[model samples]
Target: MNYIDNDPRLQTGKPAGIDKISIWIHPFLIREPSAFHPSSGNNKKVILRYTSRNGFSIDFQAEFFDPFKNIFIQILEYLIGLSIRGILKSPINKDFSTVEKCFCTLFTDLFAIDCIEFYFDFMRGHLILSNITNQKYKTTRYSNNYTREGKSVIIAYDRIERLKYVNQMNYDEISSIIYPMRFEFKLNRTNCEYLHPTNIFGNYNVIFDNYLIFLAKRWRMYNQQVVSIPVLNNLYYAEKFKTIIQYSQWQFPYSMMNLEKTPSCPMPNKSVKLKDIDRNWAVQFSLKDWV
Candidate 1:
């Protein structure tokens, strides 16, 4: 995946293209008093709040690779394969392009899927998706008026049965069924700097190089997990694992200095394993040091 030069034709905040997807870090994640904590379960509860002023929005024009889209497709296909093989019974007939469109609709109609708004549990080494809600509004300047709109829903990651049913339905039905739940959680009011980990400033090449290394490490760790898609209930196989590894490496090359060796993972199986990174080797060395 070579980086595409900025196109003047792209409107101010539109996605770069099919190849690019941006991840936004939530303001809460980097705040001085971070809402996230390793110990407290309540603190860890993920809540996505949308208001008229700032409905959930993630800017991806800066970073082009679409990890969310890639991972979503991988999981969707894996689920479909399971259904076809008799492990599960879900109707999945759509091609990659159709499924991709469905995913975009999910973001636009129901909830935002940008990296920033969601909580990334770094300590646990998995991404977490939780309940999402729309904020109610009240205005009292001229006259007392109150209005509440938008839907809320809790996506239970542990409930594979519910997800299976969802995968079987069309986009409209899925949206209608999943978009409404009560918004009950409290919002974090603390202010903080929004630093998307991948968007660190400096030389463009250096930042991209470091970002790729970070993504590779994270993806490898994610691939090694027993449950597929971590917080989401889906199963993955050897072939799909290979596809993920290849896709990540292809999108972000670890090194331009040397092309002799690249990141590699073992075949995906019941007992699949990830190779350890060698700090001493140029190929495995962290780009952070040089950057």
Candidate 2:
């Protein structure tokens, strides 16, 4: 039930995709007064919350990036439901009120992006060794945050486990997510513009595609340095890793990376002693393994 598209990620029991995204729409874009209750604070100082009848909510403020409810997640769910407001599916129904139509039209608007966070489930044999950015990484038990308060924050953490430990969750409350090790890259408006000069605001697929672009770029590099068989990992990342080769900096890693090491044990008694040498007894990796 997790992926109705028969997405192979279900096989891995992991969630891999855009984990979270935040954007700022021009305040005037949403003028439903009934939706914005009241606030005595000045326009610059006050934040307004908007909740649609269907339980969709987004907070608004005039600033580019404020702590107010800058998250608009319901749109992602809407896209998953096979609804793209007529772009990918069917056009908007004509029976809607003027306000509804106005809201629907802006779905195509070039968004003034605020923040986009990309994440994935990270299991064993993963190490974030990329030092391409000039910023120093802030290390914590749960995450490696690069560029804490700048154009972006590239962080890798197992927040699910962090929550379990921090909140002292019971076994039942603990999340069943395996290898919850996740990589999150949050880009501010400036970095977002750099990645996609044309801008990242478009349909849901477009937003997700940009995240894919980043994930692919990293996957290509990370695969090479990994200690495990790249193909086995590729098989693990069927949902998201396959596209990485599309942006491989150099040629993708060869199947040889998956070679197994089998070490012979010492003889049963003192009479014979086996050498400590490691034996790669299995078959060599085949080129087709990556296919």
Candidate 3:
């Protein structure tokens, strides 16, 4: 076997763009989440009403407006645009090595996160610039020779927060402020080989489950990951914690509002007639139920 081929580390990790990963994550994460949250009002519509940090209530809408605003997308646009524009006024793209250095430095400076976690997507000969911040994500192909049009959708989330629970605001409650914000990307499916087993913590298994529980109890989670709840199509990750006001996960359609038509019905059957409409009747059923 070839020397490079024989190495297991080489097999597990790709060498291309391994040196310049920070450039990738800084833009993609912000763009994708922006599309999901559009504007302040939209986030509120998506998220349930709740108070946090000094009587400030942020549904999905407010969270998108205030905090999760610019960390990634705007910065990426600036750097990439500078690269294309050859704008000497900007510090980046003075030289190839300096450009790479600028990307890494700027990325770490803005996100306060590590550069190694991002994976660069290469299609044909170009890099795919979607969902770069998410460590675990999938990519699809488009067109172009030097640049391949690619899209990425986030499968999971790794968020760092200051509260014992997610999105809670008690500055006095905060104890330690860790630098370079700690997080790992959540894959739609888990594979043991990629990460050290103990690193994952959550309701599902990956590696950091226990640590997540510890954080859940000790730190207030300022960061959040809202995705489609696997079992409940109409539900989101925050809707699940209905009983726990401090941190809510997996927001269901009914949880957000009381309505006649169930929030997430496959579509709607015009032929089917309804009488009294209550959310209780539409409890989310798992995939196994249909199977």
lDDT of each: 0.27, 0.37, 0.25
Q: TM-score for every candidate vs. truth?
A: 0.20, 0.45, 0.18
Q: lDDT tens digits, residues 1-291, model 2?
A: 223125553432234544444433333223243534433223332233333321222332223221111123344333223223322222234222422443343332312334455545555444342333223322222222324456324455445656565565566655664555555555554343333222334432344454555545444544433212244344445444444455555553332222112112212221211232132211232212210
- In terms of TM-score, how similar is model 2 to the real structure? 0.45
**Per-candidate alpha-carbon RMSD to the true structure:** 23.5, 23.9, 24.9
Residue pairs with backbone atoms closer than 3 Å in model 2 (clashes): 86-90, 86-91, 122-181
Ranking by TM-score: 2, 1, 3
Model 1 C-alpha lDDT per residue in residues 1-291, reported as the tens digit of each score: 221224343322121122222222222111122222233122111332333344322233223323323433433343334334433222244444533443333222212233321111111223233323212321001111112432111111222224334365455654443222111101111111122222332233333333434333345433332122352222121222233345455545444321122112212222212243222222322223111
Against the true structure, candidate 1 has what lDDT? 0.27
**C-alpha RMSD in Å of predicted model 3 compared with the true structure:** 24.9
Residues 1-291 of candidate 3: C-alpha lDDT, one tens digit per residue: 222223354332222111111121222112222232223333132231212211111121111211112323433444444444443122323444544444444332212211212221121212222333433222222111111222121122221232343455455534432211222222211111122111211111111222223222211222222222223222222221212223234333322321112112111221222232222211332212210
The lowest-lDDT stretch of 10 consecutive residues in candidate 1 is 183-192
